[model samples]
Target: MSDHVEEQEMEAEALEAIFDVSFSVVHDAQPFVWSVRLVPVDCGGDESEELEHNHVAVKLVATIPPTYPEDCGPELDVEIERGLAEQHREEILGVARDEADANEGMPAIFAVCEAVRGWLADNNEKGLEDVSMHAQMMRKKKDEERSKAKQEQKFESQKKAEEMTEAELEEIAVRKRRADGTPCTEENFLAWKEQFDKEMEEEAAREVAEREREGGSNKKKGAATEIKSRRDAEREGRPTGYELFSGKAGTMNLEALEAAAEEAEEGSDEDDAVTVEDLDVDENLFDDDDDLDDLDFDDDDCDEEEPEI
Candidate 1:
């Protein structure tokens, strides 16, 4: 057969097979470029309405060549719906092209169309399953995180309570009950706490002031103890250093010691008198040097012998 005749026969067969498929022309012109939208007719759920509308479907814009498929394959552009992803569109196109190439130069438009329809139906089933499972997983993760946080907070609260003294914990429980607006039925504890809560800061300040007063009283006690200790050391006769050298504190009590000191100083001049022999000097040596030649004097001798009177 001639090349032109064979191509025309292939074109007629391809058109007859796709007669059921709804298609439009390129740019509204009745040209060779065909724009086709294919939707799955029997997808049971939300996608079933696609059979009634052109806007929601897989789209194919193809240019079928006059030459045989052996020399020129159909140029196909596949598009998925707006909300759908492009990766699945590629998968659908790959299956469709494989089907069309298998029946080359023949009525293979239906094969390509059927391949696309199968992909869409599978996508619809798997999409619902995966989406439902993903939502369940997200809810589970959120619940687990919230539960973990609550456990950690509870552990911290328990540790804080354990660290407190028994008395301190009782005080805290009292205050907490008041803050939570509890009823005063429990031994009137709530009413008592309510009265204090109004002046809690001032009460804390008063506690500090009481401690300071106690500290000052302790200092006074320490000073009195020190004074008593010093008086005890003096009574024990620890010399107390010089009896007369004591300052105002010693003199205030040392009347007998001071009188004895006065008596001792009064006799200081006569009682402490020094004779000429005490200095080892000659008494008549100022008369002249009459016995100087007769006396044997040493040059290094500092003391002179006393002459008889």
Candidate 2:
């Protein structure tokens, strides 16, 4: 008896489980249930008042679960939700209706839920693979962009270097100026050379003229010195022409010599006259015209005939 009672409770639990599951499905289909009823009717000549056919009626006064998973199957939940909003059409509405009808029973709802769960799991795995592939593609594109930027920078640098090289070569090839900072044109160079030669020549001529002037002044000075020395000697009563001419040999006879001595003495009073000591005359001499005229006088004989000898 306890076993039978336990069996009856189990069966009641099973029936209640099925009813609850069906009610949940109906609720998912719409918003509200105004009434829910199971009516019984007798069928096939069973006149027993207790046995009848039963029909369950559920009246939806308001929509429950106001929206569907956009369209059909849980596997396509992401696609349906996105696709249905873009294309609000009869096809997507029909898909929602079919999903609701198919899940009206407890067994069907359970089977469909299991299949949808598996599909969602598979979709998540595929989404992970797609995400990985997209990340790899982004990395490759970034590397390629970096490589291109570097290549462009190098090309620009090379172009600038080449331009600089060209400018430097042009500068080197062109002639500029001389070391003295003068322009190296032919006309200018020749003009400077001529001017330099002219200046040098003028300088040489001036030097030569200075030397000649110095030499002439020295010669004039020497001549003036000689003349001054001669004049000094004359003033000092050094030998003069008159002194040499009026020696002792100049004396005649006594009277004539006396007269001559007197004339000499008188003449010596003047600065230009001969002196007595300078007169080369004889101390003793006859006053005869014949003797004076016959005197064979050589300069040496006159010197020998001097009275002092």
Candidate 3:
């Protein structure tokens, strides 16, 4: 037997053993013809549950030439018996042919079958991806349609308004009359009310802000005035109201005390002055041991004292 014929026979036997029932010999002559069903590689998933699942089983036909496995490769054709896209069928044929070409001077049936299977697997994955992309596109289309519907509704409303006759517009205004029998459009009441509410809120906010500002200013001013008054009283050597009321009257210097007593005497009228007899002291509130003679009097106290009117 010829070397090329032997090689072809060996390839046919190997393919039949590997593929079993799926492999068939059409002609067993000088130009041998056989077909092998090609199944794609497994894509790890429950493919039966997938919506975009596509399982490929292409029949690859090969014809061995006299120059097979030597100077030339086998003639190859693809038959999609189970059904596949024409584009994919052509692409599978191209891949098989390319594999055969690469295995020139060698048995290429197994390599060609594997190449076609790989192509089917890769294309199946791409189709699944395309399905995902299609879902996204559909979602986007729905959103656009909703938006368009809204716009169309608005356009229809405007068109209806434009198509209304003058009398129909008047009737609508009458039907929308307020409880006081005044049409809303007669004075643009809604617009005016909106503006009025906005202005009122702005005014109220301004008033609140003004009151807060003034209150803070007055508080600071009162605090500063109180502090300045205390400082002045201390520097001028005078009694503060707190000192007088809190039994700290002696805290005032003698000079300030004397000056204050003299000012009080000068401010008093003769009729308002009290004599010793004018005092209504009970005198019994004191103990019997208390005596007027025990009171110490300064020698110049009489000279400084005011005389009776």
TM-score of 3: 0.37
Q: lDDT values of the candidates?
A: 0.60, 0.44, 0.73
Candidate 3 regions with alpha-carbon error over 4 angstroms: 41-54, 125-309
Q: What is the per-residue lDDT of model 3 for residues 1-309, given as tens digits with 9 covering 90 to 100?
A: 987788788988899888787789999998899898766643334456332455455789998888888888889999874436566678789999999989888889999988888876654433222335675587467669878999999999999989999999898887877434855584698789989999999999999999999999999999999999999878788766876534355432334434445545577765655443344334453457667667655545634655332
lDDT of 1 by residue, 250-283 (tens): 3322334333344444565644544323342334
RMSD in order of candidates: 25.8, 41.8, 23.0
Superposed Cα RMSD, model 2 = 41.8
Candidate 1, position 286, lDDT: 40
Flag regions of model 2 displaced more than 4 Å.
1-180, 238-309
Using Cα atoms with residue i matched to residue i, what is each candidate's TM-score against the true structure?
0.33, 0.20, 0.37
User: Between 2 and 3, whose lDDT is larger?
Assistant: 3
The candidate, 1 or 3, that scores higher on lDDT is 3
Per-residue alpha-carbon lDDT of candidate 2 for residues 6-79, written as tens digits (9 for 90 to 100): 43334334534644432222232223211111112223334343232222111111122222223222221112
lDDT of 2: 0.44
Error (Å) of candidate 1 at residue 15 is: 3.8
Q: What is the lDDT of residue 189 in candidate 2?
A: 88
